[model samples]
Target: MISSIFFYSTAFVLFLIGLFGVLTRKNIIKILVSLSITETAVNLFLVTVGYIKNGKAPILTNTIGSIGMNNLKFVDPLPQALVLTAIVIGLGTTALSLVIAIKLYKNYGTLNITKMGGKR
Candidate 1:
């Protein structure tokens, strides 16, 4: 019970911190890092949500002899699968953003958005 609460709270706090960083930071690289942090928080939250106390993996084994699925306590797999996909997508997005940031830096010679905009 306590562990569950802690996991959820930690995920929420991480997400909030990432959001704050993205909203307040001016450097493109910092913003990309913030976005990755947000992705991590989301993935953690999803995995946490799928957790079951004292539950076994979603797999079948001979140990469970004649007992059927109705009697077994197995952790949900959907959230885990979704999180895996999300992780891959997040990696791709982060890579793309990094490439774009590199292009922007090469063009403007600065990673700061405001500075790139010709502002003082």
Candidate 2:
């Protein structure tokens, strides 16, 4: 119970920190980094949500017979799969955003958002 609370609270704090950074930062790179941080926090939260305390892996072995009506505790796997997908998507997005930022920097001769608007 306590561990779950800790995991959830930590993930929430990381999300808030990332949100603050995204809102307050002026640099495109900083914003991208904050976005990645937010993605990480969300992934962490999702994994935590699927966690089952004192639970075993969702695997059945030959020795473990009589699967029916047995008190077998297995951790949920859906959230883990979802988080993996989100991570891949996040990586693609971050890479694309960085490529755009590089192009903007080359065109405007600056990485600052405010400075980029003045000349280009």
User: What Cα-based lDDT does every candidate model obtain?
Assistant: 0.91, 0.88
Question: In candidate 1, residue 88 scores what lDDT?
Answer: 99
Segments of candidate 1 deviating more than 4 angstroms: 66-71
lDDT of 1 by residue, 5-49 (tens): 888999999999999999999999999999999999999999999
TM-scores of the candidates in the order shown: 0.89, 0.89
Question: How far is 46's C-alpha from truth in model 2 (Å)?
Answer: 0.6
In model 1, the Cα lDDT at residue 87 comes to 98
Q: Count the clashes in each prediction.
A: 0, 0
- Maximum-lDDT candidate: 1
Colliding residue pairs in candidate 1: none
**Poorest stretch of ten by lDDT in candidate 2:** 61-70
